[model samples]
Target: MDPEKVFHMTGGVGVTSYARNSSLQKKASDMVRHITTDTIQELFIKTTPKSIGVADLGCSSGPNTLTIIKDIVEAVEGSSHKILHPPPEFRVYLNDLPTNDFNSIFKALPEFYRELRQEKSGGSCIPSIFIGGYAGSFYGRLFPNNCLHFVYSSYSLHWLSRVPPALYDEKGGSINKGHVYISESSPPQVSQAYYKQFQEDFTLFLRSRSEELIVGGRMVLIFLGRRGPDHVDRGNCFFWELLSQSFAELIAKGEVEEEKLDSYDVHFYAPSKNEIEDEVRKEGSFGLDRLEMFQIESNNEDQKDDHAGKIISYGAEVARTVRAIQESMICHHFGEGILDHLFEHYGRLVDEEMGIEKIEPITFVIVLRKL
Candidate 1:
């Protein structure tokens, strides 16, 4: 399945929409806001352009959409004011797949613009910030050569261009078998396939950014990653394993076919810090400035209440978050009939198994400067 065509956050303001379930992503974005501000300040200090170009790649439409732009503009204004320099006009690009809900972002623009005006009246030097939506994959070029001063991607870049090519054995049998992602039990070829795909896609990502970013331009990338080079890190692999166990439960009831579960895998992989650094080095376009990993709760806290049971609440939150991002792709692969049943089973598995399963998810925040 084509990820561009099939993959998108569940659209609109429904309960499962990314709009509702993206607090985790917003938190991840918050973790890197300082890096973004510091880098933008450095860029302005070194080479102040009349018009600053900034892009948020994989900017899925939701409450999270346009947030980084607000932060960027605020940072630019604050930096310029501190140095007694006039802030430049801002040209911001919000980019994602063609199938993304750009209209939601466009509809919210008026409020965003009004808020900026209000902030300006509150003593900020408001440069003209013009926002536009660019719909495309970040795996390829999206902006003009040397056009962007700062580029930010949060909670993206882990998605491969496609499912790993080696998912099927030479005999055309599914190699990954019951599991949906790489696990300790997966064959060596499965891990090799995932790593090879990550290497290729990350290299292309850096190369594309290198061509678009001017010399010394900056980027901050934040995404799910492993603590070490191990391909089967529990944090990276076990969440999916839990989901697979859910599928197995459904399979036992004959709610979903075993072959369907066996053959399907999400087109996503979380890399290790070393794996990311290696790809960046091989791409030869950007130099790493900062790389750090930080932990986040597997589920959002707002979903919890004194009334709700802990296990159910945790499972439900995780199910909602996963459903928001992966539902469309899963629907595409397995047909839409099974989504409710699938997530229900998935949630049950989480409630039953998660306490014992050592799943401590950590994310990587990387700041890189163009050569």
Candidate 2:
């Protein structure tokens, strides 16, 4: 699948944008501030230097990116008392896939800069921005070695490009085609191939970032994920599967064609805590400073008396988004007529499944330092 096209459709302006607003950023900022300040103060007895450089890898456009940067500034400021000299200037780099909506990010920057300038103290400080693309992957040689002071990436990097095509080659006779990620019912070999690809991608990421950070520099990653006993099922991105199923149903009903669905695959990985730690260790780059996992409180729960009702309502909304993409061919499949019935079916299924009250838990704020 084309990374640029997928991001434009999903990450450009949709639920992804909503996820990266100022409010979410503020929360992430506070978390990073607390962790970094404590780690720096306790670990490095010496004073910190002025003019710190920070990077937000995979920082898609909007308040979320700015929020993380702001929090880093605050954390540095708050720790000034511990340092003998005045605080340093901040240079922040925002990075993403080439196809990310950089215009939106740029548009939001002036206001973000203004707010920071207004809040500044007497100390001289400069804030700078750099934009670039992480073309192949996030895990290697993106920046000069040992150049950065801090790094953060949120709600991104969980996705990988589609599996290589060779894995799906069919033999002379057997029905075992060399396909990749056909469906949840996809062959175990295909699933394993995708999993191996993610592992390699993540390992490279750790190693690359390890080389980029100064010995004491910090990095944090906050992203959408899941947890379960089984590693294979842990990052259960069922929403995409459901969407695919919906699309298949539409195709069977003559609402769309198989050709349109040809180019896309929902790519995400949800690794267990153990899985993440193991991968990091294997990479041998950074030492894990911290790890924490928590669930974002869903608004549906607070508004409804019946927990089951709330679950159903939330599920229906999720399904609605999926169906909207189908109706509009957002992923380049199906058409508009299927949207109404799509919602109807989704709503019915969710309402019936309310007894399960399923919720997606976001995972892992990992702070790593180059060893």
Candidate 3:
């Protein structure tokens, strides 16, 4: 299946929408706000572009995209006070796949602009900020050359441009059977295929951004990553493993076809810090300003509270979080009928895993400067 066509978060302001389930992402972004604002401030002070062009790739629907823009403008405004140069105007671009729910973000802009206007000074707005949406993939060019000054992406980049070509053999059939991602039982070739895809896609991303960003441009990228070199480590792949285990149980009961299970493969990869560094160096268009990996609890703190009798509810919430992001693709591969049952089994597996040990996902905060 073409992921661009089939892949998108569960849209709209429903119970399963990404906007409701994205607290984890918000927490992760909040943890790095200091780093993000600091980078923007420093870049602004140095380059002093008359109009700062900021692109937030993979910015899904709702007011979150506007929140990013607001923070960036605040950061630049803060730095303008320290220098003699006048504050730069803002050109904010929000981008996501065409299938994403762009309307929600658009509907929320009036409120955002009103809030920005309220922060007025001398009967004028703080900065002349313009917001527009660009719908497409980020693995290729999205803007004109030398137009962007700062770029930011959060919780994206792990998705491949396409499924790894090596996943299929000469006959064009899946090799990693009964599993959607690389698991501990997967052969060495399986890991190699995933890594090869990440290498090519990430290189292409850097090249594309290099052309768009001016010299001395800075970008902040935050995404899921693994702490170790092992592909089977419990960073993010383990969640897929739990789903695979659920599929296996369904296959045994004849509720889902084994062939259908084998036919599906997740178009995602989590690379290590060394692997990321290697690709950045090899790409040679950008220099790493800061590369650090941090961990956050997989489940919410409230979910963890009152855990004595809340295992099932806790697991259900976790399943719902993953469901918000992946239900579209899962429903496309398997029939929609399987979602309730499939996630039920998946939730049980999550509860069991959580009972066994704590699950904290490793995330990478990478700051890159155009050379």
**lDDT winner:** 3
Candidate 1 per-residue lDDT, tens place, 1-371, comes to 78878889888877678887787788888867888888898888888888999999999988786788888888887888788888899989999999898998999998998887887797755579888999989999999999999998988898888998788878767898999998888999998998999998999899999999999999988899888878776685778888888788888988888988877988888998889888888889888999989987664223553223443367777778899899888888788888898888777666666666646888999999999
* Ten-residue region with minimum lDDT total, candidate 3: 299-308
What TM-score, over all chains together, does every model reach?
Answer: 0.94, 0.76, 0.94
lDDT of 3 by residue, 93-176 (tens): 999999999988888888888887787745854578888999999989999999999999999898888889898889988889
Global lDDT scores for all candidate models: 0.84, 0.58, 0.87
Worst 10 residues of 2 by lDDT: 172-181
Those runs of model 1 whose alpha carbons end farther than 4 Å from true positions after fitting are 123-125, 298-312
The residue-by-residue lDDT of candidate 2 on 113-203, one tens digit each, is 7787777655546444443334434655678776677777775666664443434456422121321133445666655655677788788
Clash pairs, candidate 3, are none
Backbone clash count for every predicted candidate, in the order shown: 0, 7, 0
